[model samples]
Target: MPLADAGLTAWSWNPLTDIQVMWSYPFMVNAFRAGAVIAVLSAAVGWFVVLRRQTFAAHTLAVVGFPGASGAVLVGVASGYGYFAFCLAAAVVIAMLPGAGQGHGEESALIGTVQAFLLACGFLFVALYKGFLGGVDALLFGSFLGIGDGQVVLLAVVAVVVLAVLAAVGRPLLFASVDPSVAAARALPVRALSVVFLVLLGAATAEASQITGSLLVFALLVMPPATAQLLSPRAAVSLPLGMLIGLAVTWLGLTAAYYSPYPVGFFVTTFAFAAYVLARAARTAATAFGARGPRPGTGATGGTPHAVEEAAA
Candidate 1:
């Protein structure tokens, strides 16, 4: 059945029919596949990103790629690869910056400076090759309908490499993130780890930018991990759970966008935002109503033997 016959139209009331329709199309299948890969990678890296307080860096990388991708399109180059390369280079430079903390204002200042220059270069490239404007726009905003088999394979490869690196260094990364002073004292190669993680983050951002658009990649990367933190601060439990949530939101967003008039990026972002809000609310409620007791050895309710004996005897 063709996508049209399967109810890909915006007005389709039967979700089952819409899903059937979308599944029948190879492009839609590939889009969802790509989304799943991006989601997993984003969530995993994002967990560390939140722990390290690098949300600004993630957001900056997403936006900075806009000009690189646009410039590639204008110059008749492979825009995806160009954007990835540019982002990786930028990540290296940012990681190398001297002792500058990842403060929001400072990060934003650096990112804004880089973004302004890239945007200008992007515009210049577009002007030199006016015919490719539509292609550039599509890359910037995203077009799930345009994703091909080649892009899917590229995303898969990137995802696999990133996950492998993340797993290999997972323990040290956590240690450094939670308590850098102790990690450094142990001579754990903290700086090298930070550099490596930033590179991997750059790769993840590049992959996510393809599906979520450069502007909204942060939605999937930052939001899901932040949400997971709210629900459970323990890295052991929250890490895997966060990835699951990210994957679920991506799949849901893609499905919803396939049948609705809205763009896929919009749906994906909306789902991420909603998840964050819901998780925060649950956390707040739990904190308000959950367990509470006096300190041990300081009160009648303390867990001392006398208290236990008095209560029981």
Candidate 2:
């Protein structure tokens, strides 16, 4: 199931022909399906991640997946179990740790300490699994090759469950994210929602890692959502925009990687980063050009018309 063979060769001349060829292969089909799952799930979950300021947690869960997979391999178990188990465990630990009501410096230090420790554990497991454990880089930066039908099915099931749970709590989750004090005052179960969100984040991180690699899941999970948020003023438009950007990046990256001799994760990450940069630059330019700044407020306060000020004199 070496997907490289299914890719465009020197003989591929026409763009349409190359696409058809890429789509004709079964492995390519699975790759597309898996990539799509990652794209949508990651982006959707990433919107919340951005809102909650939980990128550090997201990255930690992603890195935790590597050790999970490696340890599973060492124990002759499925990697998915290891990934899910470790990520959920990490999320619970993080949720229990002191983040709020503590100094930002102390919280960040604690988070960083957990990250460092996890990375060390991942490397240790990789080192221990000396029997055909595959490349360390490959484990960190995943590949679509050899992905089976069962995995595809499992991925779909996991995604549906995550999205369903998200939908159930969407509004209250939004409230909690924006203003936890108000949400808690309203008796909206804010703490439970925070814990649930962390679990969802872990699930999304693990799932996204299957396609984008453990290290590179941030591309799908952060860049597109961040870009969308920067560009769109309204959450209504921004949330779906992030998913669209993610899907575009995944599709284009997969196609480009098919014709070129590079890993799909590399191309996907590059495309995501490029999109984010372009969005940020465009936002900056618009702000610069659109700034008409500080019209004399009608009464020296904000948002009033600039004219008719002489009456006061």
RMSD of each: 7.0, 7.1
The digit string of per-residue lDDT tens for model 1 on 37-72 reads: 889999999999999999878877877677777777
lDDT of 2 by residue, 175-259 (tens): 9999999999999998889989998888899888877778998899999899887766567777888999999999888887777
Alpha carbon lDDT of residue 34, candidate 1? 85
Clashing pairs in 1: none
TM-score of 2: 0.86
Candidate 2 lDDT (Cα, 0 to 1) = 0.78
The number of clashing residue pairs in model 1 is: 0
Question: Which one is best on TM-score?
Answer: 2
| Local distance difference test values of all predictions, in order | 0.76, 0.78
lDDT of 1 at 295: 30
Provide backbone clash counts, one per model: 0, 1
Q: Which regions in candidate 2 have their CA more than 4 angstroms from the true location? A: 1-8, 11-13, 100-104, 107-110, 131-134, 293-313
Regions of candidate 1 where Cα sits further than 4 Å from its true position: 1-14, 104-110, 135-137, 291-313
